[model samples]
Target: MDWGLVGILLLMGAGGGFAAGLLGIGGGMVLVPFITMIFTAKGFPPQVVVHMAIATSLATIMFTSLSSVRAHHKHGAVQWRIVALLAPGIVVGSWIGPWIGKQMNTSALSLLFAAFVTFSALQMILNKKPAPGRELPGTPGMFAAGGVIGVVAGLVGAGGGFISVPFMTWCNVRIHQAVATSAALGFPIALSGTLSNIYFGWSEPGLPQYSLGFIYTPALAVIVAASVTMAPLGARTAHKMDVVSLKRAFAVVLFGLAAYMFYHAFA
Candidate 1:
């Protein structure tokens, strides 16, 4: 067995799970760049490296979502009604996203993911407060927003929190509540991304051994084991810290991740 690889994956999962709980990001944002690095370093097929990283990251989020959301739900922060209304649209959107993604080459996908991460990080840095009179949108508007979020999440293999949390806050939802609700949203996003990646990648050649469609099962098992343990701890910390400050710090990290991916794409 490759102990070094196992160690790296374990560490990745732990960090990703913590981020999922703390930022309601479902851990994909944290996992994607590093997983890309791992796949590239291992000499995986150039055409499939980005796709595999994204697909695997989304798969990990499936576990982290449940673990983190459970913790958030206990704090009474999740908005179930909002989750219900948004989910249907999210599901439909997610189905479309992978098809769109498959049309792009690895370089294009990586560059796009870099762009997505950078945009999200900038929003945190700006910290734009909403107008007091703003409120959650009507059902139609909410559904439309959910579709957009889902599509983007599936495209980049993220949890949709980057867009969802900010959108909720812009609609005057409290930050804590928005975070929790975003965590809840991770489920559908992860589910769709996972399934779609699998479907899209199923027939691709040169997949590494132990792969399930686009997912590397060995890494998936190890990452899920570690992430599930750390998620609740991160959730507890989220409640105690100055969340805005934490978010700003995380944004800086996102910037670095984005830069690296940009380089990977262009260079």
Candidate 2:
């Protein structure tokens, strides 16, 4: 890999990993938009740039998730029972989501991606703390929630934390537990989506040289290496900081990026 490219990847990873830890937002919310800009600058076809970015983000998330989950698990923050309950549905649904996304036109896919990010941001802004006495959703309900989050993960090549964390919190899991369990789920989301994107995009004509299906390997390598170290750092900071303002700041950033993508997709 080019040293310059590796440097870029490391920077991306650091930013993504830190945000993942701090906000409990899927790193994809940050990763996808920035990666798309890189793809565009690299002379990648506009139609496929978002797909490539999403695919690459999923690949990077595989590593970032592992690091973040390790940190969270070390603190005994993860709810393993919930992970077991949700894994089956998440695995199946995540695998299918990206395959379907890959089949759509790139413009449609980008718009859909932007819409999803916008909705997630809105949800973050609007959702309030659940009542103290809230109860865990039953096993069946957890499975259904997992399926929904899986589809979102697949469609956008995200870690699914935005959906999963909120769902867990709504089900009466504490905030930290929700964040940890969601981190655990990130591996499955990234693994399933990356594999599906590979299958769906394989043999497609005129794809950039050295790309693995939808994923660009050098980009993935850069993003993963940097994000691993930084994500844990971000999580540590999140624990020490007041996060409401941070969430809003991230939301503004996401909205601005989404708008730029919308212009690129349409103009």
lDDT of each: 0.88, 0.81
TM-score attained by model 1: 0.95
Tens digits of per-residue lDDT, candidate 2, 53-159, equal 88889888788888887777778888999999898889888888887787787788888888988887776666566554666677788778788888889888788
Best by lDDT: 1
Candidate 1, poorest ten consecutive residues by summed lDDT: 127-136
Error of 2 at 76 (Å): 1.2
Q: For residues 195-261, could you state the per-residue lDDT of candidate 1 as single tens digits?
A: 8888888998989999988888888899999999998898889888887877788899999999999
TM-score of 2: 0.93
How far is 8's C-alpha from truth in model 2 (Å)? 3.4
